[model samples]
Target chain A: MGVSVALVITMLELVGLFTFATSGALLAIQKGFDAVGILVLAILTALGGGILRDLIIGDTPPAAFTDVMYLVVPVVAAAVTFFAHPLLQRWTFTVLIFDAAGLGLFCVTGTLKALRFDLGPLQAVLLGVMTAVGGGVLRDITARETPALVQADSSLYAIPAALGSAGVVGAYHAGLPLGIVGTAAAVFVFGLRVVAMVRHWRAPRAWTRRRPEVGR
Target chain B: MGVSVALVITMLELVGLFTFATSGALLAIQKGFDAVGILVLAILTALGGGILRDLIIGDTPPAAFTDVMYLVVPVVAAAVTFFAHPLLQRWTFTVLIFDAAGLGLFCVTGTLKALRFDLGPLQAVLLGVMTAVGGGVLRDITARETPALVQADSSLYAIPAALGSAGVVGAYHAGLPLGIVGTAAAVFVFGLRVVAMVRHWRAPRAWTRRRPEVGR
Candidate 1:
């Protein structure tokens, strides 16, 4: 990877990590968790997806554990949220944009990584989506709520990640430059997610409450 | 490893996997999940810890995915629970014993595996406890509940797993025979867990509610 590409990926991943960590901290506050709980949620939200990806891909100890900055980023985000709740709360829109960027970047990166490990393109795309959304799934679980990925109330979320990942895979197969592929995929996902948020575009939910089947 | 020891470990692990899967299925039933959710929970709860362990230790794709029996056990367990909810519901104590057995075996085996991978005794013991409790954690999270391991209302669960892992580590470092050491540790965890359950030996909960602090 070129130095600039490497730099872009790292920066986007960091942005995603911080946003998810903030989300986690906010949930912790809502759940009335003490300081320890906030930290726990933030750290998990930041690292959970990557950890799961690393584990599945045979990456031991996970980069988050080996690299100090990854751990420090979540801690800093959580601390900031804990200390400045109101100020940060008002910047929800800004945070969402960063989060969408992070999601887009992670999906592309995770898919490419999985592909490098010889996973099928389909599997790679799934891993990409998982990388994008896994952290939030963990965050919700920790806070005792249905994961937003699977919730009825949420707008299209995982769909954008999947679409972004598929785009990267498609671009790679078509021999596009890696830089262009990654950037285009991330922008598409980020743009779609932001638009979905604003316009309230939603994924269809399952038919509501099928009548309980009669007598077993 | 001796054939006898290997056989014993396999049997115990199967029992553990089945029980944990049952626990997952039961929880899914409680949550009113459909067939797909029940199976997902069952399989995840059955295989999650081992998957996490293998990943941490750099084992890719996880053994559960490759081994058909491992996949089959949870599927069967979920199907049984789905078909015979009332009958299985009455067998809760039986399921608990099996779950405890699985926990004990997993902790012992997980620690031994970590040791073989050259993880320090401390890290190995932690992996051991993780292997014991990881599945249930995934199950609870998927169902949007605090894991019983981390819950304040639960009896000593993770404690027995930890103690079992510790004992194996202690025994190994003390230069005991592996067979005797592993069996003893498993038995100890199993006995402790069952006794704790029977006695309702609760872990102390943090004080009910310190009145949520107001005014940020």
Candidate 2:
């Protein structure tokens, strides 16, 4: 890992964190959660994925917890959304774009981290996709909603991430310059997500003859 | 640290995993999920908490993944529930008892693991409670239901685990024999959970003047 590459990854992570936090804060606002809830959701959405990634790779304390900058970014994003959400609420598309960027950035970075930890390419792809979607899952769970990732009617979310992660792993294994390949992969994922959202593309739901019902 | 203590803790963990898996499998049956869903939920519910704890403490590959018995217990539980669900469905109280037992055993074992990893007592207690309830939370989330831990109308769940974890931490700090004290704490938690269920005990929800609604 060159110094320049590390710096780039850090910048990408910061951007991803800020965007994810904003989305979480907006969702909290929409959910009628209080101010404290907004902050909690924001922080969780920002750091949850990275924390999960580090944990899987056996990193202690998690990088997000150790770095003050990572913590500060989400808090700042939450506070901004807290005061400015009324103005931001009209721009749902902007939020979707930001979320796509996060999905892209996290998948690449997460795959890199897993590979650095000596995980196989297959496992790396799994962890990378998890890193991209884990925070949103946590946020939805805390907000008492079914996570969109598993919702049959929801637009494609994890597929783009899996593709991005697989690309990164392939690039790494082929001895390609990761800094360039990683950035390209991230952009590819972001584009795919935006297209999926705009086109309302959905993953296939299970076909069942019987009506599904939840019983106590 | 002693061989006998290690064996005892392992036994508790296996018991906890089996019970949690059973609860998860039952939930899958209630949700009308397929056989694969039942197995996935059972494995996740049995191993999720322990894995979370291990990740926090930088334990790589997670004991549940590395040890064959840990994986085997959940598979067996899921198979039992899958074949015998018609009979098991009538015994809701039995399922609840198993869940309570899991809660008790996990709280004790989780705290002990955290303490061994040199986490502070407060942090250890938090991790312990998380370990006890984390599986249930994951299970509910996957089943597309609000986690019982945070649901306003749900019965007291995390509270007993917190109390048990606190007692375990206190006992550890006091240099008491951990095996005995830990067993006592687990028993105390189990009794508290069963009583709470029987009595319909609930943790208070936040009082709100405004109507609460989830908006998209």
Candidate 3:
């Protein structure tokens, strides 16, 4: 709750918002969607998970709906992505880094938020993962694609988020300071995600056709 | 709030739950999803909208999550659909009827719930439409299909839901008895949806390539 810690979380959130909105707008542009489509996807990507979480925690109107800045930031990000996409296309790696950072930041924050709302540690962890990945799942669904959260062959996503969520929830249960535990959890998630991406790590596939070991 | 009125809404809600769950299970079966997949979609399609509405209305834990019967009904429906989809496939018209019934029922119920939470007429009506159509959107998203809720070529899905929501909100605004207005609003939606289906009514497309007069 110190000023520096609060400042860092805020910065992470803003960066995450921008990256998620950019990704949403980029997807819309690729799909040849109109301006409205771009705006809708951008807003949903940036704030959908938080809205879902707030709603579950009995927060009416949602923070996004109330905070003009939160709403406007995503729109601004989307507009920039839409207009400067050609130049931004070359910055895919940077986008991925920022996206991973955002994922980590959100998972820890979400779990902490749930804990603050007096949810059980288990529910807190799960909701944390939901908050981290829900927006991307929604964005993919809107784009008519199999969401990465559920896809078996996709790179590490929900798993890393879940780990980060568990970390924060566990730390909270151990009576650790929120600022320190949150930072450590976020770092853990961000590091794992970035490494996984760099190594092209694929998660386990559940329904592989090559299950010859269980042959009839 | 009369016993009879409450009973009627309860009946409609149960019927809607069954139909939505069945539709969700059927979709999962069609998509070759496992039992878990069927159950997930069934539950989501039956309860996702109400959960969304409750979250929006600051109703924590959601009724579906808390009520044992609400959780069980969808599971039962999914199981039935899983085992009897072949037989149920022949009952397409029956499914349509139930789906339309659910659409009407949820809109009114959601709006009423929102009103109970002291929401304004606009939010109530919007939440009503969201409750009506949200399950199907989640269902389609899970199926990796473009949801009909926002598709241009799809029939009057959101339109009818919105109209039903508007009817209830308007009647309430006009100070009509809840029991009478609620029933009447549901009936109006059901009748319109059925007629639209039978007549093959298609809503107009927004982005047709043949905006011929706009250019050479």
* Best model number under lDDT: 2
User: For model 2, how does the per-residue alpha-carbon lDDT over A1-216 read when each residue is reduced to its tens digit?
Assistant: 678677878888999999999988888888999999999999999899999888777786888989899999999999999998777646667667777888999999889888877777766886798788889879987897766665545677888898999999999899899999999999999999999998998754323344456432
Arrange candidates by lDDT, highest first: which order? 2, 1, 3
Off by over 4 Å in 1: A2-48, A51-102, A115-126, A138-146, A150-153, A159-216, B1-48, B51-101, B118-127, B137-146, B150-152, B159-216
**What does candidate 3's lDDT look like per residue over A1-216, in tens digits?**
457556655666667777778777877887889999999989888888888777777767877888787788899988898788888655656656756877888787778777777777666876687678777778877887666554433467767888889888778788777788788888899899989888877653223222312100
lDDT of 2: 0.84
**Reference-based lDDT, residue B60, model 2:** 89
Q: What's every prediction's RMSD, in angstroms? A: 7.4, 6.8, 7.5
Which residue pairs does candidate 1 place in steric collision? B16-B102
What TM-score would each prediction reach against the true structure? 0.59, 0.63, 0.60
- For candidate 2 chain B, which ten residues in a row score worst on lDDT? B83-92
Q: Report the first chain's TM-score for all candidates.
A: 0.87, 0.94, 0.86
Ranking by TM-score: 2, 3, 1
CA shift at A52, candidate 1, in angstroms?
Answer: 5.9
Residue A112 of candidate 3: its Cα lDDT?
A: 73
Higher-ranked by DockQ: 1 or 2: 2
Clashing pairs for predicted structure model 2, backbone only:
none
- The per-candidate count of clashes, in order, stands at 1, 0, 0
Q: At residue B182, give the lDDT of candidate 1.
A: 89
